[model samples]
Target: MLWIPATLAAAAAQTARNATQRRLTETIGTAGATQVRFLYGFPFALVFLSIALTLSGERLPRPDGGFFAFVVAGAVAQILATALMLAAMRERSFAVVTAYVKTEPVQTALVGLLILSDPVTPGGLAAILVATAGVIVMSGVGRGAGASWRPALLGLAAGAFFALSAIGFRGAILALDSGGTLIRASTTLAWGLGLQTLILTAWLLALDRPALTGSLRAWRPSIAAGFLGALASQFWFLGFALTTAANVRTLALVEVLMAQAVSRRLFAQGTSGREWLGLVLVTGGVGALLWFHA
Candidate 1:
């Protein structure tokens, strides 16, 4: 499926966005940096939606209760997930934090099965496990860092919330029968970001004006991160629309590899032999997944 490429591109773009956002988080609070992805990103998402509609010549699918329910759930869950991730990052090392977050693929698979009735074959299940193993190792779960309940629970909860967000968005897109997959994905992205922006803006207006102002003041970097955030999400939605959320998220584990490469090239960090082994397993798992689909 074209979702394979889409997922790969999303992973790379998302890694860049994460790096940008991480820097921004140092200047602005985590909430503000997190809000940037939704607030500034909505405009780019709108642009994507426009292009998709223009190319497909499809009318905007009117949102019914089911559509809004899913979108709203996804939006809220996504925000909570970000907050939890920020909190986890504060409490633990990046590798430990990411190890917890990487649990999302497995959680996504289970949630997709239970809520979306998406089925995975035994081979598909095996592929997911293999890929997840690679991701866990890459995340430094092998470092044995989940020692405390606080950070561990925070990370696990964040992963679950992220899983819920994926499932919600996937359900929302599939509920829209009036458009092509591109149209469906774009529409979902636009609405989800819009809702997230509104909610986060309202929160900042009421409670943390400085963080909000800080985000606005840091417009240049914020915009770059926002644009990439939107771009990554656009492709993420496309993949979700084309296949099961489990499959999409499983392949999405390669994001860690992409980020690791960036660290190596940009930060001069070295990868260990174990990391290379993890990469090989991820590659093999991806091949197995593709074969299973075929």
Candidate 2:
């Protein structure tokens, strides 16, 4: 029951953040908007981390060499994922893109089992299969929206990167021996976000000065989106620490339904029959996971 509400709240918050990101993407382009999210939000995360450290009376852990390496690897994977996802957003609906991204739960579970040696039960595998089918249904694989294989491929790559990011953060959390749960999670998030900011800022400056300059000029909106993104990530990291990454990410699929709602209200895009079916499948899959875990 505790996991139920916590997961639902995280999912809701993430959906709102993604909606803000989608709006920013429209104005600045995906890559530029992602850079804005990290650059503008880094300070807020730093402030939060500082407060957390002070209150907890804990010094930042000296991350093990391997831990820092994992963090960098995760950061790189996330950057690549964000780039691909932004590009995919140009050609795909937010709902479709998000639905595809939810496949990360499956990928993460597999990677966790293979690399981290996390065990998976039969029920978990069943839930993953159901959820994957829902993603396929929502993707309009056979229906005609002029959807090509390219967007799906990019979305899958995004999911893979997201899986790597999860594993990296989890590894970091395991490495830390100091601080309470909240403090540890917050510290890891601060470093991860900080690394992402550095990498993305450099990437933007090198490849697209105009977009970076434009994003800076639109600081008001950019900052708002950035704050939401940071806050959303904070909750997500906490959830990751408390639960299995597979479970947390599987529940995060609710973001797709939330995105669909946003599209209907904000863009006047109605949900299609196929999308409704997909929703039913996704809901059932989530229910199954919860039931089995319970």
Top-lDDT candidate index:
1
List the global CA lDDT of all models.
0.84, 0.78
Instruction: Encode model 2's per-residue lDDT on 1-294: one tens digit a residue.
Output: 454566677677667766676777888888777787678878888888888888888888777777787778777787787777777766788788877777798889988888777777899779877977887798776566555777888888898998998888877766677667678778787888899999887878899887788789889988887787677777777776676777777877777788899878876777888989998888888888888889
lDDT of 1 by residue, 17-134 (tens): 8777767877997889989988899999999999999999999987788999999999999999887876776666554455567678778989899989999889999998887777
TM per candidate comes to 0.91, 0.93
Clashes of 2: 0
Deviation from native of the Cα of residue 173 in model 2, angstroms: 1.4
Best by TM-score: 2
Note the clash tally of each candidate.
Answer: 0, 0
TM-score for model 1?
Answer: 0.91
Q: Kindly give the stretch of ten consecutive residues in candidate 1 with the minimal lDDT sum.
A: 137-146
Total clashing pairs in model 1: 0
